[model samples]
Structure formats: structure tokens, C-alpha cells
Target: MVGRKKRTTICDKELQKEDLISNLHEPLISEILLRLSTKDAVRTSLLSKRWRYLWQTVPGLDLALYDFLNINFSNIDAFFKFVERFFDSHRESWIRKLRLYLGYRHHICGLKSWIDAVTRPKIQHLDVNYYSSDEIPVSIYTCETLVHLRLEWVSLPNTEFVSLPCLKIMHLKRIRFTSDTTLEKLISGSPVLEDLKLFGCSNHNAIQLRSHTLKKIDMDMDHSSGFVIDAPLLQCLKTKIASTKDFQIISSGFPAKLDIDLQWRRRRPLERPPKKVIRDILADIRRVSDLVITSDILKEFFLYSKSRTVRQFRNLSRLHARFAICDIEMLPALLESCTKLESLIMVI
Candidate 1:
């Protein structure tokens, strides 16, 4: 009887501990559920009656169907159905963040419906990666509460008006824009935007980016014609342009860091920018503290560094460059231009 009594006492303590934990505030429990993946969070319903409906009120949802592309028709239908049901079951109208990594493109209708359903007024962050060919819904641009948006392998819709009052960070990868003015319009609409990244986006005939609150602009455009920047408050600028006539910084913003990669093909070596043009380009970014130039751009700078008209980069403190065989011969002249350079990184 004594041994049985001790065992019973231990079991009672365990039960009491669990009861205390189960009685935690609903917001605290929702936070715990938010940290879990959608599938795992929903599975918690099986843990206890209290947790059964807790996931329904969680404000964040991260859903990734890894095998979505390889699944059969029946499985795909069932997967989408489950997603639909999950959204339908959510009790809260406002989602803090929603991320979806979809593998297939055939479900455009379903994808559109899902995005429309989740892009509520209170949704702050939305990230969607669709590997298939599909244009992003125009509704995304109107999400007034969106703070951060990232879209991969999507085409931008041609809309007359775009107003994202709260958007600050935007990242576009392999995106297709309808017209040259589409990008300009998009940037103009986001009054408080700070950071923008464009990676391999199409319809880059001549992009004129003008923003009052922008701080950082990063572009990797291989097929771009030209870019004209007019952001007065910009601080960081990075670009990888394939054409010699690709980009020019027209702003007096004076970015602190500049990373430029000019891809000059050897077959058409004469396509390199003229010495005067290279010098003028360097003059624009002379205020940059940290500067990174690829081998192609370094070759142009080396050719022009011998000229007396080349200005010194007084503010440049860090210099990073890839040294080609020709660049090694003009290394001394290049170093002379960066009078305040404190760090040098050379890659062969």
C-alpha cells in the first residue's frame, strides 16, 4: 500500500504540471503554434482538446509541399483541398505572414484563389515561389498592409494604378514586367519603400527608379538596356550589368557602398566603355566608402587611370577587385586613385 501510494503521488504531480501548462493564455499557446509548420501545427490538435482548435487562431502560416510537383493527380487534388480547408478553418481574418512554395504551374486557378483568400488587410509579409509560368495576381499590389513582399518566377500584371502604402522591402527574381514603365510605377506607388532587389527581370528597356525613401538598390540584369537612378536618399547600390551602356546613377544620394560587375565579352572587346565614359562613371560613385569592381570594369579603369583628368576617390576606404592578366600591369595606377583606401582584396 505504501509503494502504491508513492506511485500515485508521482502520477498526480505529473498531471498537475500538465494541467498548469494547458491553462496557459491563449495568445501564448498561439505563439507556440505559430512557430511550427502548418502541417505540424495542425497535427497538435491530436495532443489535447485545448490544442485541437488552437492552430486555427494562429496568425502565421508557412506551408511547403515538397513533393507537390511529383505527386499524382489524386494526391495533388487532395493536397490543394487540404490547403483550401486549412484557410477556411482559420478563425482570424488577419494573418501576420504567409509563405507558400508551390512546385507545379497547372494549378493556376487554385493558386490565384489561395492568394486572394490570404491577402487580407492585416497581412504584413507575403512570400510566394511558383516554379511554373504564371503572372502574379494584380491584387498583391493593393495589399496596403504589406511590409515585405518576395516573388520568384512570376510575371507582374500591367495595372494602371498600384498603391502599397506600407510596403518597405521588395524582392523580385526572374520576374517579367509588362512594360518599361511598370517598374517605375510600382516604385512610385510604394512611398515608404527602403530596399529593392531585381534579379534577372525582363522588360528592362530603360528603367528610371525614383524614390524618396529608398536606401538600397540591387540589380542583376544581364539583358538590360539601361538604368537611371534618381533616389536621393539611397545609401547602398549594387549591380551586375552585361552591357556597357547599361546603368548610370543620376542621383546626388552618394551611396556609401557600391558593387559593380560589368560583363564585357572578349569576342567583342571593342564594346568596352570609352576611357572618358569609365572615368565619368567612377566620378559618380567617388563618394562610395566600399567599392567592388569585377575584372571587366577594372580593365576599363586601368586604361583610364593613366589620364590626368581622372578624379581621386577620396571617400573610398575598401577596394575589392578581380585581377585579370592585363589588370595586374596597371595595379599601381589603380591604387593611386583610391587615396583613402584602407583595405584591398584582390582575386585572381
Candidate 2:
């Protein structure tokens, strides 16, 4: 009797729970749908007539060519048609975010028009990862309302007008800039940018990163490319020095956490040892508390030192090193330099 009573109570509650969600206001339903992916949001239309256009009116739009409506990859035209319909049918006063990903080169033809349609009056976040030779829309450079911008595998535009007054976070990977100054113009215009990351970007032999408001920077560069950092308030820096040019950090002080990857010195009749470039960087950042370095840095650096004393790095507290068997002789020299080290990590 007790078990039967429990089953009856559960069924009674299920019967009492009607379509309460449908009874809510359209604003509430739209808010609920906005939290869903664009494809899942459109699926709600099957639930009832009230949800027919709720997805189109959402504040955020996330559309990828592969995931939209389960479109067939064999027919690329169908995907384009769906995108056109979504742009034409959807209406919004302000879009908070738009994350778009295009897979193939054929999609480049429609990129300009699609960018225009989505560059609304108050779009804040725009993330686009489209691989193509075509340049991204020029409107993106002057997006005043954008706060966070992330681009990958896209060609940057060359325009006289470059302004992003509200931009805070910027991340670019595999981007092809028209010229070296094209990136500089964008960085100069962003008055409030803080966090920056660059990985495997091309079309520049030497890039100068001069910013007053920048706090953190992480980058990867080739042996032919170089960086000139001049951020006064930078807190942390992680980058590789592969250039022969003597680079300097024009900061008030070295970053708190300095993660550096030093290149190997070339031994030849013409090319000389890179003791000065490696030593200058270490001397400039000697005040850093936490440091991560490779064995090549110690190999070329400590081998040229006249004395094995620990006078350079008096403020270093934590040291992490990836030591190789060939350069294990310099490990003792590095440890001997960090007199104030509280933590030591080694990878052999």
C-alpha cells in the first residue's frame, strides 16, 4: 500500500505540471532560448507555435557552417542559403556576441556581405575564424562598440581609419597583415586594450608592440621575425627570441613572471655567438621574481660569463628550467645565480 501510494503521488504531480513555460511572456521565452546554441535554438520551433521566431530574436548569435541545421557538406549552396535567410529574417536591436566559423575558401565570397549584416549598432564580442586570402571587412577595424575581438586565419585590412575605443581583449592567430604598420595602427587606436596574444602571424619581419595600457602579452615567432616591446605597465611576458636584432623592453620594470625561449647560437665562420642578445635580455629582466628558461639560453649565456658569481639575479625567487644532457654543465651556474630562489623546477 505504501509503494502504491508513492507511485500515485508522483503521477498526480506529473499531471498537474501543464505547459507552464508557454504561459510565460515572450521576453522570458526569448531569454531562455538565447542561452542555447543557434542550431538548438531553432529546434525549439517544433515545441509549439509560440517558439517559431524566438531564436531569431535572441541577443547572441553563434553560427558555424558545419553545425547549422545539420546542413549537408556536399551541398555548400544550402548552407549559404540558410545563412542568407537567417540574416534576412532575423531582427535585433543589439547583438551582444557573434561567433562565426567558415571552413572553406568558397565561403570567402560571402564574407563581406555577412560581416556588414552582423556589424550592428551595439555588437560587443566578434569572434571569426575563417581561413582565406581575402581581406576581412574594413568595418571591423572601426567597430567602436566592440569589447572583445578574436580573429584567426584571416587577412587584415589596410585602411586609414583604425579605431577601437572600447576594445579590451585581443587575440590574433595566423593572421596575415598587409604591412607591419597595419598592426601598429590597430594597436595604437585601441586606447584601453589590456590582454594581447599573437601566435604564428605572418607578413612582418619586425613587429613593434608599443602600448601604454597593455598588461600581458604571449606570442610565438619564427627565426626571421622579431619583436620590440615598449609597454610601461606590462605585468607578464611570454615569448621567443629568434631574431638576431638586439631587442629591449622599455618598461618601468621587468614583468613579474617572465617565460622566455632563447634560440641557439650559430657557430660558423661568419655568424658569431649570440651572447650579447641573450645576456642583455637576462640583464634587463634580472629583477623578475619568477622565470622560465631553456638549456640553450644557459648554454650560450653562462659559457661566455667571466665569473660564476650570483650578482645578476638577486631578486629571482622561482626558477623553472628544461635542461638538456648536452648543456647540463650550465645548470649549476644557473642555480648558483638565483640566490633568493624559493622554488626550483627542472626537466631533464
Model 1 TM-score? 0.78
Candidate-wise lDDT, in order? 0.77, 0.76
Candidate 2, 2-58: lDDT as tens digits: 999999999887756746777778888778877677778888888778778777777
lDDT of 1 by residue, 1-348 (tens): 999999999999999998987899999988888878777787888889888888888887787766443442255667778777777766456677888877554464588777776675578888888876567778887888999999887778788899999999999888777778888888999999999999888654787888999999999874787888898998888886554546677877678888887665554666666565576667756667888877677666656664542355556799888878765876776777777889999998
TM-score of each: 0.78, 0.77
Please state the error at residue 333 of candidate 2 in Å: 6.0
Model 1 weakest lDDT span, ten residues long: 67-76
- Candidate 2 residue pairs in backbone clash: none
Candidate 1, position 323, lDDT: 74
Indicate which candidate wins on TM-score.
1
